[model samples]
Target: MEPEAKWNGSTEQVEFSRMSPRSQGFTKLPGQKTCEKSVLLFTFVLLISVVLWGTLLFLFLTRFKKIAQDVEKLQESCVYHNDSGIVTIIRRLQVDQWDLKNDVPQLSKAVNKLQEDQTTLKSKASQISQQVDRLQEDGTTFRSQVLNEKNTATQALEKLQEEIEKLWTEFQRANGSVCKNCPKDWQLFQKKCYFFGNEPKTWPQAKFACINLQGRLVSIKNKEEQAFLTQKANKKGSWIGLRDLDMEGEFIWMDGSPLNYSNWSPGEPNNQGQGEDCVAMRANNGRWNDAFCRGQQEGWICEKLATC
Candidate 1:
């Protein structure tokens, strides 16, 4: 096995074997050189891409930061303006509230005063109404009293007028130049003055009283004269001039006149025990009756003719 020994042509194998790995790699095959060139070109392109990307990122960051700062300032300005507006609104609202508070008590006091005045007015109105009613009552009473007084005064005035008329009549008779004027309390009828005596007297006394007065016992001539004497006679009857003193049955007048007209009652002149001698009007109708001449008292009617 040790017997074989060989020799190269020029020791080429020995030099190649002796070369370093880096020297070996430097020496490439034909295809390997092409691959290496390709690799180098790829690496160069990647480095250029990374640099371009970084530059674009830097520009974007700067622009974005500037925009953010501007946005922040704008937001601050807006917030400040909004706060000022809110403050103004709040101040206005507070002022309004203060004004309302100040006016509330005054309004309430005014209302209370109005209510009190209304109450006072109501009381005064009621009092005025009552006073009016009282005044009306007083007026009614005064009117009634005035009416009564007027009625009484009217009656008194009428009575006084009647008395004045009577006085005037008396004055006319007293002052006039009448044919047959009557004295006080005497009445004139036709052409004669007549007196109706009030005192009770016997026939003789009655005759004397007539003579003193320039009159005689009434001698009724006719129906008219009888009616006048009857009207003047009292209710009990009054004595006339007719009597039967000179004769028992014959009747005559005191003036010496015969009995021309006689108005005798039914069944009268019976002489009644022979004492009835004088004639008197028995009733208001002028009926005649014989009465006692001397012993009995009687009213008498006297008459006198006119001398004018």
Candidate 2:
């Protein structure tokens, strides 16, 4: 039997497996609305434009805010640097005033001592000159008489030179060659006792003066040694065992060991010289610098070998 049809519905059934029908019939097919179509297209374009504008605005705002923050950070950094610069200047000026106040008296005393030494040497040299004049007269007289006598006098002249050297050594020993009964603050170590009082000195002058006392400056090797020095230091500032670098511009101890200190001041041993050659401890106990040998005061330090 064939399929039955119902009221208000189509009864025909169509099947097209591999072909198209020439005509089709339905209750009614809904037509596409042209006004609605135009309205949908316009809405899509409006949404796209809005989305594009919003994305661009968001990106622009983000970049502008980041740039503004960077500018503010740069201003803060500049301000911090300015404050630090001012602080450093103030500290330096105060140090300068303190140095001048203390250095004047100490320098005057040193000058006086040097002047006395010069006077004594002058007197001694004058005496030697007079002796030379007399000897020359005697030599002239002897040479006229006997060549053998002048030969004997040469030995006598050598003896006199030796005696003069011995006397000079003895004089140095009496004055500062030995640290006898030094104060507790300036305790002697290995025949060298230091005074950590006032101003920096070139390594050469410090070493040379110390050697005159039959001693050298105390050599610092480690942390303990540096601590001992710091303890004995006078807050007034003084010379320590550090010095100008050797030929290769490498820092070394007086005994020629590599120099490494336990305590150092801020930015120490910068050797700010166009080409530095000397170092001295600054008024601030732990500070140091490389400087010209002559421009600054040759600070005083007395060194004397210990009595065995």
Candidate 3:
């Protein structure tokens, strides 16, 4: 049977038992479709909210772990055990910088003082070098002056000695001691006697003649003896005991004495004729001349010690 329908004031009403089986089933299908649509919309919204919450939880955990690690590093970097951060280390570094700044002026002053001392030492060294040079110069001058004075004093002493010798010779002669101490025709001077011979003979012949008389040819010792002999020769060329027969230009006496004193005439003893090995006192000035040993004949003088 078909369900009867009634019109209410604002809606139409159908009785459920009076409806046919196909119409009731059709009316129930519309209500069921609406309920299914509501359930599907609610499930989609819940799933979107769950996804958003899961992403937010993951981000929060990662950020918290990174912040903990940064705090641990800051703890390790602290300078003091009680310190929490880098502030104490920074303050100590600032104090060291201030100390270095304060010491700069003192270091500069010390360096400047060293430079001044170096300059003073260099100046003193230069002055000392100059003083040493001056002293050397003064010493050289003093040595030269001393040497000159010594030479002058030596020459004066030689002259004075010659004069004294001449005076002593004169005193002996004036005392008439010549005849008492010497041979008959011999002249005495200085404890020795000299014989002036008149015979003209060669040098060798005169030497032998003097030896036969127990005397040798005269060997004049000093200026005083030389003067006396020259006066006795009386401007005659006479042979003395001087000869260079053993070696040229080195005269030696016959009595084996050294020929210490010599009175050579200017430009004489020139070994004239190349065979002049014998010496003769010049008749003109009593200076010495070298003559031929065997070719020239000359007067001779003999000398011997007096009888005391």
- Ranked by lDDT, the better of candidates 2 and 3 is 3
Model 1 poorest 10 in a row by lDDT: 1-10
Candidate 1 on 72-178: residue-level lDDT in tens?
99989877887679768888999999998999999999999999999999999999999999999999999999998996786467446545644665566678745
lDDT of 3 at 228: 92
Native-to-model Cα distance after best TM-score fit, residue 177 in candidate 3, in Å: 13
> For residue 214, what is the lDDT in candidate 2?
40
TM-score of each: 0.41, 0.33, 0.41
lDDT tens digits by residue: candidate 3, 1-308: 22332344223434555668998688678778888999999998899889999889899999999999999887766545546445766778899989989999999999899999999999999999999999999999999999989957854674465356546656776775453377888888877888988888889899888877867788888999999998888466998889998888888876556789889999978997789998888896789888998955557899876653
Clash number for every model? 0, 3, 1
| Window of ten residues with lowest summed lDDT in model 2 | 7-16
Worst 10 residues of 3 by lDDT: 1-10
Q: How many residue pairs of model 2 clash at the backbone?
A: 3
